[model samples]
Target: MNINIKKYLIITLLIFLIVNCTGNDSTYSVEVTNPLDSERIDEFVIINFDQLKITQAQQVNNLTVKNGETFIPSQLTDTDNDGTIDGVAVVLNFKPSESILLEINLNSPEKSKDDFIKRTYAEIAIKKSAEFKDGKYIGGNYENINNVKVPYNHIDHDNLFKYEGPGWESDKVGYRFYLDWRNAVDIFGKKTTDMVLQNVGVQALDQISEASYHSMSDWGADILKVGNSLGIGSVGMLDKGKVIMVSKTDSITCTVAENGIIKSDIRTRYYGWEVGNKKYNIQTDFSITAGSRLTFTEIQIDNEADNILTGIVKHENANLIKQESSIENDWSYLATFGEQTLFNDNLGMVIFYKNSELLEITEDEYSYIIVLKARNQKASYYFGAAWEKEKNGITGEKDFVSYLNETIQKLNNPIKLSYK
Candidate 1:
């Protein structure tokens, strides 16, 4: 009886060992490759023993591509040959709410064009609504960002010219129709500026965002208002007139017609400069000469601060005194054209412009007198009278000046052109 029992026990022990070895010998292999890398396939390989089963019932939290490395199921294996588990192989079994097949056509004649189109399409798909909600992809402001609908405001008109002669005459004229700030901020949020700055850098970002956010519909309404006032696009006699559309950036210029035709929109200047800060004092000898039929349609002032002068003073010409006065004081002259002011409380002229026809001259002789100035002010202060007090920094006068210059420049340039 004892021998028979030992034999049976030995057989059972052998069978258990065999089963354990078989289970340990089970192997699974997975190939890892970089989707972004165009050169090579099968970038790496990983193998797993003992065929670990992943819980398909659970949902995935998030997935992301990090640092040119990708994670695969087989890669999640114990490197140290110990009985303890080191990593896990995840198999997500939950049915996707929706599956989208992103088909890309790269049949472009040019390789560069084909690659660009393919990459852009891939980016759009990765950010698509379905993939975002499923948690298959991560990063980007997906949840917070959406197609927002808000009132649109665009550039009514932007006119720029090098003034010359005694009166204002056009040496060169450039205009831009752009999106308004209030409307743009309403639709795209204030972060739109940061978004654009990321793409185009600090210089062109604001202009591009302001221009692109506003559509042609906004442009049409604004143009109609201006045209109706001038009786150009009305139903009567002036319907068939020509409409001229123009836009000018610091570096380039563009123009188009009302019939969706592109006209003389070319890059005249290769380089451009932008105002750096709010308050500045730039002395440039610039001038504008206008003809007798010149009419000032609009005048926009960017800086509403009490003391800041945005005007023109000819070299050695002192008659133009664009002064500011305060109602609080005894009507004291706050700032003079050629002089500077210490604080923003002193009243000053911010901006001034008038629309006038060009004066016909024997020769194309003109000059411009440019003057830019700003004031320094206490932005914030504590009311306590004792020595121990608190103070905070406010928007600098130079910073205000910079914003004003940028805004005024946009107003002077329109993005679209039309024919009456």
Candidate 2:
């Protein structure tokens, strides 16, 4: 079933341009301009057929895209989730200052579609029913779910969620946030690139038992030890040097949107959240892309506050890395790297965003908080982690820092995109 997850946030600058039409025909060409001087890979672009004036014969639903002579697999998406299909999203790789041509065939003969390589996944699963009168679900068949209306009497450790909450991941890493009062985030360090969450926690649906993901497995293990701290970008507000987590919310509703061949996203609304003397409602969106480790967040609240913060857990063994962007109103990064995972191995966690949105950086015994100023009750940022065990993972501090810097630069400079 297709669900409307809201429009994909343009984390990367999306520019659609139509370059040419070879006479009156079903085939047309688009030029994608990579304005950057550095090689960019795994770039994603979406093509709207309607916008391109490309029409298929009545009842035709197939399309094929060619990058020169090479046939590339395209992912069909209902961009607006309006039931009717609108377009296809494709991945690209660009050399510095590259302009790649894409040929779109609106009425291409239907052929058996070759499966695209899946690099991302998202899931929110829970036991189908309560097993006890006290609202405890001990054990039962678990069902993957979406748009869950959180129970009013919900409390932490209820076994109401798989992996404790909604989980989203790319090939490089995995992340999840607690659905209960703590609302903290955590990371799952992957040892393989295959989509593995489905098999990772299938056996521990019982409340009396927990998912075996905590123990080392072939796919990977739950690496972060999130205590009371802002596990990894958990939403909160600063009150007297302490982070007021999303604890006193009257209600919460979660909806899963896209589960990716390209990207995956989930949206949630927290109602009547009480922080200190102020009460507010918040809407959040978290998404990750194929081949990327970053999980980006977009937040909108009913009330504006200057001290809205998100943070990463503290580790005595990790060295803190902070960078101030030289470009004003551009991006900066906050990161930590060291032997901080539950396995006591090398792990790196980072958050990067506009420096103008940052208010302060502070810490307690449990976390290092990046307090942000919310204007118009809105804020956004990206957080991610890397483990040395993952296939082709970032292992050294210098390499990790280079990754962060390159990511920030990419965010600062967007390419020109268009289709004909």
Candidate 3:
């Protein structure tokens, strides 16, 4: 074979081998169907690729349901599998509907108890100090420590001393008297007595007398009360607006309104005022079952007052004729009335119309009457009037008189006329 022809033949053979290997490594498809309805089989079902050891799988091209319709995968398959293709599920159950709330049982753990005691002691100590000072220790000035306003007196000094010791001591003291002079003999007493005195001097000294301390043991009960107020280690059911801490477990059911306001059976305890609106009724050993039901009420307006005419102005025939000619000449007429009318939070309803076609009005005359009737009897004290003009400057005195009478009559009792 020629050299060039041999090279071409070798390249063709390599291409053929590559194509054959690629075909052999191609992926295959597996049809998946819901057992409940084999006819409604889906093309793709998700599976962990790593766990299933599937490097590749045939792409899902279409999905179909028997007697239903065959749809393109992009067209028919709900992306989220929620009934709607827009990812909104209209009828599919996809996630859990209920939720669980976990509450910590503070009394069950020993560590919680110890933490509670420590927290309680610290809190009470601070509170006691506050109560001791009232409003005197609010600022940096300590002159009002005991409300005496002494200069340079420290407010926290008493508290510090309570923990430490008193500052000064009394100088008064008494000594024991010896009765027998021979027994009380000094330096010449005995060598044994001297040894006893030396031994006593070496013993531990009584430091209690040296320290001027005040014992808090007398206020132990008060301190404990303060601790209990802090809700240290107690466990209780949150009921109503309070926390109910009980000794035994009891089943309690409460209904919560839709407004999220709780009206439970628990009562307020000590320090309730300090807790403010965040108070929880601690019920001990009690479990709540059901909450309160929410109720909503809507209000509707029933009867409304109707507008009554306080006064009216009638146009004379001569004046009507003059006004008609003036209106035709591009002039307008005005009506005036003055009276104080009570509106009382009501909207004013007004309607204007004319008897002649030459007289133009902006709104539908019948609709305005209907609105005025709906007003019931709400009176408007303000004065109002209607304007009239011809389409082409045609002055008709008779027509003008008729229009004026009609408009005035309409103003007096526009609401009485019914459109329906």
How much does each candidate deviate from the true structure in C-alpha RMSD?
Answer: 28.0, 9.7, 39.2
Question: Per-residue CA lDDT of candidate 3, range 34-136, in tens?
Answer: 2221121111222222222323242322222111132111112122211222210001111122111111111122122122111000000111223234423
Which candidate ranks first by TM-score, i.e. highest?
2
- Using lDDT as the yardstick, the better of models 1 and 2 is 2
Which 10 successive residues of model 2 have the least lDDT summed?
11-20
Give all candidates' CA lDDT scores. Answer: 0.19, 0.79, 0.19
lDDT of 2 at 405: 83
Taking all chains together, each candidate's TM-score versus the true structure is 0.14, 0.84, 0.15
Q: Give candidate 3's error at residue 416 in angstroms.
A: 76
TM-score of 1: 0.14
Cα error of candidate 3 at position 64, Å: 16
Best by lDDT: 2
lDDT of 2: 0.79
In angstroms, how far off is 66's CA in candidate 1? 72
> After superposition, which runs of candidate 3 have C-alpha atoms over 4 Å from their true positions?
37-44, 56-420
Candidate 2 lDDT score at position 56: 45
Better of 2 and 3 by TM-score: 2
